[model samples]
Target chain A: MKYTGAQLVVRLLEQQGITTVAGIPGGAALPLYDALAERGSIRHVLARHEQGAGFIAQGMARASGKAAVCIASSGPGATNLVTAIADAKLDSIPLVCITGQVPLSMIGTDAFQEVDTYGISIPVTKHNYLVRNVADLLQVIPEAFRLAESGRPGPVWIDIPKDVQMASIEIDALPEPGRPDTAPCVDMDELRRAAELINAAKTPVLYLGGGIVTAGASAQAVMLAEQAGLPTTMTLMALGTMQSDHPLSLGMLGMHGARFTNYILEESDLLIVLGARFDDRAIGKAEQFCPKAAIVHVDIDAAELGKIKRPHVGIHGDVSQVLDRLLPLIQVQLRKQWLSRVSDLRSRHPLLMPGLENPRSHYGLIDAVASALDPLQADDAIITTDVGQHQMWVAQAYPFSRPRQWLTSGGLGTMGFGMPAALGAAIAEPDRTVICFSGDGSFMMNIQELATMADENANVKIILMNNQSLGMVHQQQDMFYKRRLFAVDYQRRSDFVKIAQGFGIEACDLDTAENPRAMLADALNRRGPCLIHCSIDIEAKVLPIVPPGASNTEMIGG
Target chain B: MNMRDSNINRKLNPEQSGKAVLELTVRNHPGVMSHVCGLFARRAFNVEGILCMPVGDGAQSRIWLLVREDERLPQMMSQAGKLEDVLSVARHGADHRVFEKLEEFFG
Candidate 1:
């Protein structure tokens, strides 16, 4: 059988069970797009920009816990995808990004629309390939998927020249679809030691991160917490790993975390750290963080073990596997004294929501939207947030149900991630209503995706918190930079409702609504795609912020 | 400044030469070297000397690096090992003969 390289790529993607892809077609990518149009097996989402396409792919990957694909033309197209790919790497999302390159004959002549996509993507990707031969596509395509979604998933890039895309290949049979490499075998000694530490410790805390979600070990994590009578705290990435209202749950910890969470961590003697890298935003001053605790860190990637806080026992294995073996070894305990102490700390330094009752306020807006959509016990909403004060507030106040229910740019903190990502989530799961909680500054970053949303008619509701400024930056300037506030506040307020309507989606302004809560219900309930804009106070801040370079215990405000 | 002088500035006891060698076995691919070097450069880890030769069957290569030993060497080694192209990493003292033998050619 004969197939062109472009057809081979599509066929391989189909074999990998990729029914959908997001990308922008360009001059270099024309042949691939032609094959895509002809093949008609895959659903191709036409994004306004290459970056938007990349994030859409990321959204699908993040929300579904599956490897997703994105495509781009060479040169500027590949450059635009750098942030999204980097974002995936940092957050450990499974992504395969394929870019079109100049013809092999053009090589180093600085040909039109040509860029070293493979070279540019190296640091940002887990692995990258530049296919020099048409025949190599058979191996390269499957290898890209395997490397991408394997243990400790991350983005992989494959740059194929235009000539290669047009070249023909004859094969007896197509290669098998790639799958994730098996997780590392857990060591019994490490498991016994970890269980022994948990069994013996009087004051133990279970720290969860995004890896918990990736490993699908949330049930085990929560089980261990209950069985061991351990207090649990999640990083922003690990939200929904333990339900927000679970008794053991201490909520998100570190910068912008609850005051009691950090305080409790300080008092703990053992920290069972699972699948979480000690990111600066999550750990604050590394040396000062959990100073009293002996840590037992378990991660799939061996490299992450000693990279951050050195663990007393570092287990390099899948979190689920480690927990499965370790759970039975742990002796059940109900630490009444520790629980009583945690209760005392919680009562003393609880997370304070100042304007929570006011529907127009930051925290209130998030809560109101959540309740208005799925007020009952039904869990039908997927929440994505752009990075800002709004993101933190949602993290603090939103009642997350389970893992993969909430998606946000946790590591890279890219501003333009929310809208396109929400669209992609909606595209991936059409029955679920996807909400993008975006600030004015962040919403403007990929506001063009509103048109794409309208085209797809995806079920997405954009809750725009229009502070008319970069809220997080403004708050930092106010607290740290002597209130200079330069470049943080926007001089002009753009009418987002008008903009959303102009993009051919339904729009409503909460500022004008007599009953904002009712209006929220109306917009969310009847949403194919809609923008709900509400003006928030510029002075509103995500409090309990651990000032940069300061210890988590030394947080300034709440 | 000598190694002892710098170690003194950092308030640590100076070790012998403060140098170490790393030997990496990697897949022989066009960008494998760049991937290895890029990890070092991005993390601000210094590589003092470098050499690579394709090993048996031309499908794999062995690379040797002379680097100033620091507390970050373990972390650097872990990061290097995480690269897809790299198969294994072995650490040696600065006295390793790979770079020592190449000194004569340079001279």
Candidate 2:
């Protein structure tokens, strides 16, 4: 069958087993859309915003473990996909973004609806190509897919000039993606030294990071953790690597992490950090972080080993491969005494819920909301959070079992990220219940994402913690800013339940505990999308905050 | 200062083997550091760290490289030069004035 360059891209995607696409058609990209529309098998999802499209693709990629595709037209459409692309790049989500460009002749001339998409997307994407010739179109498709999915997956951009798309091409076969040879060499001697450290330390803590997930070494990580019987705590990006309910798992580590995780990091004699960098968020004060511990940093990216905090033993290679070689030589012994000490800390700082009798407290409401979740299947449900007080609450309360189930803007504390990300997550994993935990200020950022959910009929439950204020900022101001509420008060009384209903989404309001649990359970169990608006106290505070420039020990909450 | 395209075919025999140079233009940005290094990753090409200076009205930058023979020279250089803030791209070696002085001095 004869095909144009536009049709070949779709054909290439179909050949690679892509069953779905998320995009909006504009004039410059109409031909490609026309080709897609002509194909009856591929499911195309229309996203309200181009950024939303990219994120939905991201969600799909994250859930399905394959490269998800998103498309956009020239100018603003292509530009709008930038943030999600960047997000995918940082988080290492595999995505292929196909964007329309102005005709080749008009590229540098600033023609109508044109943008230097290839140039603009360079830094944001893993690999990108501008199809200047029709003959290159076929090669660009497979190359983009290869680059996006191989060796630490990331988003790749293919900016196809309109003329190239319209041009006819005789393609034989797509070029097989060449293997990248960039991984840093691992020295067996250094690996043996790291193993020696693990074997010698009595109170060793495994601080896992996003690298484990990026390296797809969760199984290997589990083996290493279980074999050594060392307790594990993960960074925000490392959530879902170890089942939250697992005996050794201490959920998220760092500022908002479990008290036990921090205490262990502070007291442990050794820290075996896997695929995790010492980011400020994870290590509150770099100089003081893990001061007592001799760090064994294992990662694929050699640059990350001692870039932030010094590591006594740096093992560079793929986490899975390195762990495979190291685990067998180590002795199997549980650190029972250290584990007992950590458990004691866990009880002492158990999420710090407000006293039950305090009717005005927001913590009770948060706990109650958390309690309403289906405890039996809670592990299966995915929780996505926007950055704020609610995010900390969810991190502390929600029990996430699997890796990649808890999605948040960890690398970039992007507000308004939760709702869209949840919608994307739900579309990606249709069977699993995807929940969006967002505060009023955060939910307002990309509130329009609700329309996208309603349109897609996604099984996403948006739990808006309506505090009517920027809770985090308000709490800081209430404590530090002399109670000078200033502009933190979101006193504008807007009824979200009504607004959601107006948008044609199933909506409910929970003001009383009489049936809150049942209502929540039912809402999460619903077939399509639903919104649960809770009237939370505006002055609520997420405590244990280490004020700016202060040490971790100087936390607001005892 | 020794920057030339590394795409030219080279003899595989030990007696004929020699180093080739590559010049790359990249956008001046925060993470451009990694993006530049990543180009040489699996190409059997070793890049001695880029010697870069601000150019193109302070918006763009040029990366000078002393590289070994690699097949991806054109693709890598073009890809790097296509970065957001990149203005233009070219390779300079013994024939170019800037690189010639350095080549002569090293020789």
Candidate 3:
């Protein structure tokens, strides 16, 4: 059979089980788009911006735990996708990004719509390729998938020139589809040492990160915590790994964590770090964070083991496999004294939700939204958030019970992430209700996606919290910068309801509703794609905030 | 990175006396060198001297990097090894004259 490079790409993607793709088309990638049109099996969700397309694919990957694909043309199209690709790198989301390049002959001539996609993406992607020949597609396409979904998954880019995409080649059969390599064999001695450390430690904390979800090891992580009677704290990316109400679950740690959680971490004797990099945000003032704890850091990536805080037992292996072997070696202990002590601390300095009784207030608004479609009750909602105060409010108050249920950009903290990601989640899980909690500042960044959401009629209910200012920045400037607020506040407030309606989406305002709670529920319950706008107090802050360069224990408010 | 000058680059200490050389076996491709060098440049780790040439069948290349033996050198080597085109990375004493021999040519 004869196949064009574009056709082969589509076939490889089909073989990889990609039924949906999100992207925009331009000159260089016309052939790829044409091939997709001819096949007619892969449904394309047209995004308003390339960045939105990237986040949409991220949503699909983060929700499904599979490598998802995103496409863009060369030059600006490729450059726009850089942020999302970099986000995937930091968060370790699996994505295969394909872009079109100028013809090989035109590459060095500063051809129209030509930018160095391969060069620009090298620092951000796990790996990248610039396909020079049509035949190379056979190897490069499958290899891209393999690398993207392999150990310590991340984004991979494949930049095929326009000429290559139009070129044809005869082949007997397509190569086998790509699969992730088997995880590296873990050191048994390290596992033994970890087990010994856990068994011997009087006070141990199991710190889970996003890798737990990627490795499909949530159950194992919870089991490890229960078996060893270890109090568990989650990084922002690992919010849903342990159920919020679990006896030992410490919601989230560091930065905006509960005062008690940080205090407990400060006193722990040993820390069993799994699938988590000790990020600056998660481990404030590293030298002062859990200073007394002997860390047992286990990650699939060897480079991450000592990249931040060094570990007493550094085990480089997949978290799931390590837990599988280590579970049997562990001695089941109740550690009643430590449990009681933790309870006492939690009771004294809990996460203070001040405005939780009034729906008009920030925390109360999040609480009301959760009450509207309680995922804990319905078992079918995927919550996503944009960066800033609203994201933190949801992270702090939303009842996330399972991994993938919470899909926020925890690492890169990109602003315009929520709406498109919500659309992608809705597209991937049509039956599940997807809610995007966004701030006015973040919402405007990708407000154009509302048109796409309306076109698809994606089951997304965007609860936009309009503050008219970047609340986090305002708070920081107020506290840290002596109230020298500069570009944080918008001089003109946007009417988001009218904007949503203009984009053909159903929109309502809680500010005008007499009973906001009932109105929110009504809007959320009957949503194909709707925007529920609620004005927020600009002065409200996401409390228990650790100052930038201070230790977690130095948080000023709760 | 010059961790000796900054406290944030902790654990990845740069000791002036502990200079070393890194030899990498990589796939002969356009961007493989960028991938390796970008990793160092991101951390501001300087490569004082460098040499690269296609090996036996021309399908692969060997790159020798002259660098300070930062405490984070092991971690950096592991990161380099993770690159798709990098096949192997070996460390040698700074006395290795691979770059030394190229100095006259560069001059």
Candidate 4:
């Protein structure tokens, strides 16, 4: 078969089962766009910005659990897409970034619109290739896609020079590259030692992380926890690994985690950590963290076993598979005394706010909004949150009982992540309703994404917790900087309702906490991408705070 | 809170001892460092000092960790060697015989 480099890309993409592509047309990438125009089978959306294009592809990939593709031109266009590529890499979202490079001859001569995109994205991508010959284009394109979707799942870059786009390629069939096997044999001796340690410990706790969901090990992690009768504390990314409402589940741990979860981690005799590496945001102090516990670290990536703190026993294997092996060896029983102590802490420090009792606090509004979405439980409603006070509040208040139900920016506290990430989540699973919870500050960063949500007719419910200020930063400044409120507070608020209307979506205002129940009910009932502007207290802050560099004992309550 | 009581408590609890420094180089990719550090955290290894710097080229980066653990130093090196992105692992401390021999010859 004979084809141009552009046609070869489209054909290779089709072979990968990619039905949708997101990008914008520009000088360098024009030929490829022209090539895509000839193909009627594939769907392409011209996003407003190169960054948006990358994010849209990310959204599609994240939602569908498939490899999503995004294309960009050379120079500034490729640079703009770098953020989303970095985001995909950080979140382990499978994405293929195809960018048009300057023509081969003009590559290093500093041409009008030239950029070394492949070099720029090396540290951020799993693998990247700059195709020099047209013959290699067909092979490289599919190879990049395969490398991106396989293994731990991350973005890959394929940089095609402009000349390569116009060059002809002769190919009978696109040969598939051999993939190195990621599934290594588990060390059974280590697994046996892990189980023996858990069985002998009077009180053992299961610390789960994002790996649980990424590797589809939630069931196994839960089984091991249950078999050992251990209480489970999840990292933010690991929400829904175990039911939040389960008696043995302690919800999130570390900074802004539930008091009971932190208490259990600090006091447990043995901690069986699965697929979770100790992140500072998750484990505040290395020296003081799990002070009394001997740790059993089990992870597919063996490097994570003792790189943070040394584990008593390190088992290298797939989290789910290892848990399955370890379950049979654990003595089936709960440590009654340990359970009682943890239960006491759970009740005493239950996730709630006294101010919420008045039904006027920001806490009350969040609770009401969460309650309204409860009916969608049967339909599998998903929530994605941006960072700041609201994100922490939602983590504490929202009850997520299913795995992969809560998608938020846990590793990187990128504010604008909520909307695009939610849009991606919704696109991945169309049957599920994706709710984006953003602070006033976070919403403004990626407000343009509302149009993408509208264009796609996604059933995404956007909850804007409008506080008229950067609540988190403002609180820190106010408390720590002697009430010196600088530019943190936004004097004027944009009418989000009008903004949603401009995007051709329905919008409503739940001005006060008292009226959240009614507004949420209405939004939940009729929704094809609707925004709920819930007014909240500007002074609200995530409390029971552990001041920076301070011990947990130095926590201050709200 | 006085110094006298803290010293007395230290005397009563002497098990908290031993420190070693280990250096690791991993591919400069997203979450490679996070995955490595997360392992350290899970093991409850006390990190005395840690420093990370990118190599001039983007291919790899270096991480230095000062750990306070007696029996777990070998385990940490073995784990570091297992990471997918890790290029090389080396331990440098008075405790490790390899480093001690090199030091003895050089000195």
Candidate 5:
């Protein structure tokens, strides 16, 4: 059979089971786009910006645990996807980003819309390819998908020249993409040694990270924790690995983590780390963190095992496999005294939130919204958040029940992530309600996505926590910089409701409503996209903050 | 050398700043190096030296990373071995001459 490279690209996408591709087409990509139009099986989403396209793919990938595709023309279009690519790299999202390049004849001639797509994407992508030959498209596309979704998944790029897309090639059969190489077998001896350490320990804390969710080992992690009666604390990326209300769940532990969680970590004798790299944000002053504990680290990524804190027993395997092997080798014992002491500490220093009964207060408003959403009770609703105070507030107040249910930009802390990610999540799971929690500062970064939401008729309920300032930075300045507020305030407040309405989405102001809860409920009940602009005090802070370079135990303002 | 003897050798070395060689057998793939390097880069761990070459009909590659000896080396060895394409990782003493040979050639 004879097929053009463009046709083969579409065929390969179909072969990979890609249903939708988010992108913007240009001259360099016209052949590919034209081929896509002719094929018409894959739905093409026209994003307002390439970055939004990239993030939309990320949201889909994160939600579905599958490789998601995004496309863009070369140069600025490709450049716009850089941040999202980097975000996927930091957070390990599987994305296949295809960019159309200038014709091969104009190579390095500074041709129109030509940039080194391969060069720019190398640092941020797991692997990248420049398909100069039409026949290579067959191999490259499949390889891109394989690399994107394989072990420790991240973004992969394939840059196709316009000429190649128009070039015809004859093929009888497409080669099968190579399967991901299997992980090394777990050493039973190491598992036994780890079991011995766990059996001998009096106080053991299971510290979880994003790897558990990535590897689909959440069930195994939970089983290990419950079977051993170990209290657990998770990093930001690992939230919802254990239900928030689980008795042994200590919630997020790190910079803004609960004081009691930090105290418990400080007191534990054995630290069983799962799929988590002890990031600086999670482990403050590494030398001082879990000072008394002998660590046992298990992770799929070999690099994460001893990158920060050295573990006594470091087993390199999938979290699920390692736990499955270790679970039966160890004798389970109850740690009543340790659990009681942890409970006492938690009671003494519970996560303090401003009363939700007082809806006028900023924290109160957050509490009210979270409660109205039934965040604690329902695991179906997905919440995506932007960075800053609102992010921490959501982390502290929202009751998350499962992994991937609570989506936020934890590693990159990228602003403008909420709305687009919500769009992606909504697209991934149409039956589920998707909520976007954004502060005023973060919202404006990618506010153009409102048009995308309206265009897609995406069912995303956005809660804009409007403080008219960069609340997180402002709080830090107040505490550390002697109140020299520089570049932190948004002096003029934009009417977000009007802005949202302008984009053809229903919008409301929560601050002005006499019955705020009823108004919010009414907006949420709408079948289409909507936004609730919440005016909050700029002075309100995310409490229990550990100042930069401070030990976790030295947190203040809870 | 057997895995048990190697474990004993690692335990005998206590100098945290001494140099160590990690030799990895990995499937030959474009992204394999990126995955290996990205892991170290994410943790801000530096690789003092690197040597990679394909082995046995280009199906697999052997990568030798020279790094400072720290308590984390054992764990890092375990981690490198867990990468999808990685078949095994063997640690060597600083006296291993791979990097030295490369230095001599470069010099």
Candidate 6:
């Protein structure tokens, strides 16, 4: 059978079970888009911007735990994808990004709409391929998918020339997709040794991270924590690994993490780290983080084991597999003294819940939103957020019950990630409700995506925490920079509700309503896509911030 | 190879700067190097030299990474060996002479 390279691209995506692709078209990508139009198997989402397309793909991948595809034209279009690709890499999201290039004949003649897509994307992607020949598409396309979703999943790039996309190729049969390499087998001896350490330690803590979600080891993680009777503290990325309200859960630990959580870690004799790289944000000071703990690091990526905190026992395998073997070997013990000590610490430095009962305070907006969306909790509800003080507030206020439900740009901390990612999540799970919690500054960064949301009729409820400034930076400047604010505050407040209305989305100003909770509920309930603009005090801060380079034990505020 | 063999290999040469060679046995697959390198890059850990080639039955490859000897090296060694494709990691002194040979060849 003879097929054009463009058609083959669509066919390959279909074979990989890809039903939707988010992208925009350009001169170089016209052939591919034309082919896609001819074949109706894969639905294409037309994003307002190339970055939105890239993030939409990230959202879908993050939501579904599958390799999602994004496309772009050459030059500026491809460069626009660089941020999202980098975001995916940092978060370990599996995405395959395809970009169209100029025809082979134009090669290095500085062709119009042509950029070295491979060169630009190299640092950002897990792997990249520049398909010089049409025939190589058969191998490259499948390999791109395999590499993207395989071990330590990340974005992969494929730059296909326009001529290659237009050229027809005859193939007897497509090559079989390659099997992903299996993780290195877990050593039973190491597992037993880890178990021995856990069994012996009077104070043990389970340090969980995003790897638990990536490995689908949340169940195993919960089981290991319960069986070992260990106190658990998760990084921001591992929020929903253990239910927020779980007794063992110490909430998030690090920079903005609860003071008690860090205290427990500091006091622990053993830290059973699963699938979490000891990131700088999570570990206030490398030498001081869990200083008393003998680390037993279990991760799929071997390189993470000794990268920051050297483990006494390094178990390199799938988190689930390692946990499965290690769980039975652990002898459950009642550390009444340790438990009481942790409880005492928790009571001493409890996570400040500002608006749990009353939602009218300056910091009560996050709590109000959480309360308003409680009904959606029983359904498939997802919360995506951009970076700022609001992001931390949502992380603190929301009780995330399961993995993949709380999607935020944790590692990369990209400012404009929420709106497009929420759109992507809504696109991936149409039946679910996606609430994007964005600060005024963050919302403005990718505000163009409001049009895309309206166009798709996405079921997204955006809760805009409008503080009228870059909240986190403003707070930092206030606390450390002697209150000298520069470029952090907006001189005039933009009417977010008016902007939402202009984008064809239902908009409401919660500050104007007599009953803010009722207003929030109304917006959340009656939404194909709606934005609730909640006014917040600029002085409101995400409390209990561990000052940079300070130990987690040393926090400035609550 | 075992620790003794690696130690003997290190002992053969006397050029011992404050560098260590981490020999990794990894599955021969695309992106394995990226995974290994990315880990270092993320932590801002600098790798001085790297050498990789496929070994036995073409199913696996051996990678030699030369990095400065620091407190983090022990942890880095464990981390590199924890990669999905990595089968084993053996550390040698900077005197391993693998990069020296490559430098000689290129020079």
Q: Where does model 4 sit among the CAPRI classes? A: incorrect
In Å, residue A245's CA in model 3 sits off its true spot by 0.8
What does the lDDT read for residue A291 in candidate 2? 67
lDDT accuracy of residue A336 in candidate 4: 87
Of candidates 6 and 2, the better by lDDT: 6
Ranking by DockQ: 3, 1, 6, 5, 4, 2
Between candidates 2 and 3, the one scoring higher on DockQ is: 3
Docking class of 3: acceptable
Q: How much does candidate 6 score in TM-score? A: 0.89
Cα deviation in Å at residue A210, candidate 4? 0.3
State candidate 4's DockQ: 0.08
The better-scoring model by TM-score among 4 and 6 is 6
Per-model B-chain TM-score:
0.86, 0.55, 0.80, 0.67, 0.81, 0.79
lDDT for model 2: 0.75
Give the DockQ of candidate 2: 0.05
Per-residue lDDT of model 5, residues A1-558, tens digit only: 899999999998888888988888988889999999999999887888999998888888888888989999989999999988889988888899999999999979999889988777867877788888998887788888887776678898888999999999999987675345466689788788899988888989999999888888888888888888899999999898999899999999989999999999999999999888888789887767888899998877766655677677888888877887888876777788889999999999998887667655666766666667644434788889999999998887778888898888878889988889899988988888898889989899888989998999998999998889999999999989999999999778799999999999999888889999888777776667999988888888888988888888989888
lDDT for model 6 comes to 0.85
Per-residue lDDT of model 6, residues A87-164, tens digit only: 998999999999999998996889998787766776788778778888989988888888787778889899989999
Please write out the lDDT profile of model 4 over residues B1-107, one tens digit for every residue.
12233445655766644566688888876556665776677567767656687997877898877776455566677756755567888877636553444455556
Better of 5 and 6 by lDDT: 6
Write the residue-wise lDDT of candidate 1 on A211-274 in tens digits.
9999999999999999999999999999999999999999999999999999999999999999
Per-chain TM-score (chain B), model 3: 0.80
* Cα error, candidate 6, residue A115 (Å): 1.7
**lDDT score for residue A417 of model 6:** 95
lDDT of 3 by residue, A205-267 (tens): 999999999999999999999999999999999999999989999889989999999999999
Residue A352 displacement (Å), model 2: 1.2
Q: Against the hidden true structure, what lDDT does model 1 obtain?
A: 0.91
The stretch of ten residues in a row with the least summed lDDT in candidate 2 chain A is: A355-364
